[model samples]
Target: MHVLIVGAGMSGVGTGVIAAAAGHTVTLVDRRPTVGGLWSPGGHYPLARLQETADTYRFPGHPFPSSVRDLPTAAELAEYVRSHAARGGLTEAHFRLSTDVRALRRVPPEEGGGWTATLVPVGGGGGGKEQLRADWVVVASGRESGPPTPMPPVKGLDSFRGRILSDRDTFGMGADELLAAAGVARPLDTTKAAAVPDAVGSTFNSGGASGDPPPPSPNSVVIVGYGKTAMDLAMTLSDGGATAHVVASRRHWRMPSTFFGFISSLPVLYSRAATVVMPSWAATTPAARALAGSLWPLSLAIRWLIVAIAYVSVLGRRDLTGPVPTAALDWFRQSFCMIPDGFRRRLAARRIVVHAPDGVATVAGPTSVRLTSGVVLPTTALLWCRGAEHRAGLSFLPAADVEALFAAGDGVRLYRHTVHPDVPRLAFVSAYNTFGFGTAVHLQATWLTEVWAGQLVLPPAAAQRAEVARVGAFKRDILSCNREPASVIMDRFYSFFDELCGDLSVEPVRVGGVAGWLRPLSPDWYAGVGAEARRASLGVTV
Candidate 1:
């Protein structure tokens, strides 16, 4: 079996490793010169910006260097992946490096079945575009693009005098070029700047230099977005001694890096406690949805319980993390911040300005921005950290195929965010946002592999479609008032994991009875579960 995996990032490479190990010939294609798509040039650079501990964030078969016991630098992780790909049976021939999968179309059985994908050379070399066909196709192109799909321009953006930067535009430039672009005066001594490895003199990127923003921080930049990237930008700026402001239409939920002071948020996010039925489950049908809104109490209680654990996590800990937040406890339950930095402290100290509910109206001038709340802000760089919509930015698929898959803004019409029942011979890895994404993708790729290899079988198409609808209804019926998308907040990981385990005839990672209930809550706990899944998926000796 020949499998063509797209995007060559963590998701793509992870899938390729497992699939190739299964003895199916696999090809990993990415537009970037390196592995780890989002971390590569196309997305964010200076990979050191991420907050996850490297040991937990990596793929199963590979581990970071022993010296990097804690969080490894971005460059280190990127280097590790390059090494991982080179080490496996996945040789240079297994990769079509620096290539763009321009278009994809399914080959009808009448015309010799399989899928046809068009590839275009992206880098320095000039070569005629080519088409490749494969029995199985995996679109793991996990958001590997520029500045997260440009947002609606601010009213006077074109006339802005100072530099406006995006994630790519900021880190993509060299040290001096970046400083000049952001209109910041260069340090008289070029030693610090010249020695900057990945955006800073120190590879760790600690903002220890004398009153200097790390290489990525723009002087007095205004970031627009409240997601993790926005937090990172703010932290980088604060560390670099730059003034940063955040603009948002609504205040997003913010989580403490540690729920109960010492425990990382990963444990809570992927815990069994979070594996509850969502309110949107009611969205499946009008009649049932009428009662969905009434389930608000249950959702509220769930959110409260999570928050309780958060406060309890830090109950007796030293206040070194930051000032305790007394407001917006609800936001903590909506999303995990994952940033173990002093962002909240910086916010309180006015080092980082947060403009929520007073979103940006547009660029007011070359050196200032105006807000919808009738306030104007002075700044040189306007960094748009806005998020991207998955289906809208999916240009690789033919227009017809995209409409068929993502019509009605319902996102991909895939069951469990993997296989699109309506679309055969295709699967998407890392489509869903979850704390345990790596483990989930591993399971998803295996399910597809087992199904394809005749070791397992998919349910009837109707059953698959019904499952999709059922989940959609669950999301819509979640009896919560948070107004966040119903798709979030619930953890269905074990449900899918168990199903796939049964499909492969492997012992599922079940926390049977009471004691089992407490397990699988910590992020690292998945290591054991993932080991079992990997054992089943790859037939590993472990």
Candidate 2:
């Protein structure tokens, strides 16, 4: 089978590798000149680091360099991701970078049916246009693909004279350089700024330092969002000498980097045993049924205990409190933030200000922002970290197919978060939002390859749609916060993994006997998953 996988980031590369290993020809395409998606150099904002630890946020077999201790910066992970592709035997011959996939239309049934993709050079180079045909299409181009949702339309925004920047505007710079580029003066005790890398420095500045109008001095920066990006920017800006004021209307529970600043949260949160306490929409597994059916009281006690432990971990940190009370159960359903190291200290020291349950009423003047709470904040740079609007990345599809693929306001209704019940020969990876996304995407790749190769059979379309609707209903009726229509299992990854394994006919539980379940689940445990999948596909008993 010939496979055309769109978006050569982590999802695309992982999918392509699995498909190729399944004895299929795969071509990976992306508009960016490199791989790694959000982790690509210049792809992420300055000073961004992985929210996941180095051990958990990677592909199964490919490990980060020995030197990448703890969480890796965006640049370090990008290099690791690029090497992962090369080591998987994907070279230039299999990639179409700096290219745009304009449209994808299915060939009519009268003729031999397949997918025909229209391609054009990204920057209007010598290549006028091109087309490619593939037996299957995998749109792994993530939902966060297009330009970020523009800043909310607040009153007097146009009249404010100070600089206004989005998360996209600060890509590819060191912390010092980012502060400098934003016209923020460094603290008296700080060291000199490092030279910006040539890749971004050459075209980064449109004015100011290079003979254009000087940028407005950003002495005070008000960041407008409370997601991970907002928290990251708050810490980075505060550490870089600018006072950061965070404005948000709502917030969720944040997991501490470490439990009680001692125990590693990874082993506690990422283990399969942890799923017992998390109420799940997927209650098909034995443990899930046991908890929901016969052991409801036990489950309740354990869940409440988990909530107490998580809540107590951050107790007494007044600066960390949100406008509303957040429970541990809420964290399982909605996406929650992981509190970065030293962030609480920054907030306590008054370097970072939190204005929860408040929004910017207007930009009162060139250097003042009026808040909905009736407070006027002094501001120069207004950094908006509001998350991206989901760009369907399906504009290439016919109108009817597009309508069938997406549910209004909910999200792309994919069965098992991989294939659309109404669509055929098309699958998606990284479509669902979750923690440990790399591991999830890799597993999805393996499962999809087996399914496409006829090694496994999915339920009928009606049944699949019913399951999708069931999960959707669970999210709406039971899950709290209900942030996105696309599923976000949050810390419920273990159950998600189990379901994928059950579908592949492979052992859903990787650990040995009862003792192994206690160990922290690592990506390395599943290193042989693709091989296991291939063997299963060939009907070989292991």
- Number of the top TM-score candidate: 2
lDDT per residue as tens, model 1, 359-459: 67877766877878765677767777665556655688778767867653544546656787777788888765555555666667777776676655567
In model 2, where do residues sit more than 4 Å from their true spots?
Answer: 187-218, 318-326, 480-482, 534-542
TM-score of 2: 0.89
lDDT of 2 by residue, 166-268 (tens): 8877777677766775557875222312221111111111111122212223577888888888888777887777777788776456777776667877777
Global lDDT of each candidate: 0.59, 0.73
lDDT of 1: 0.59
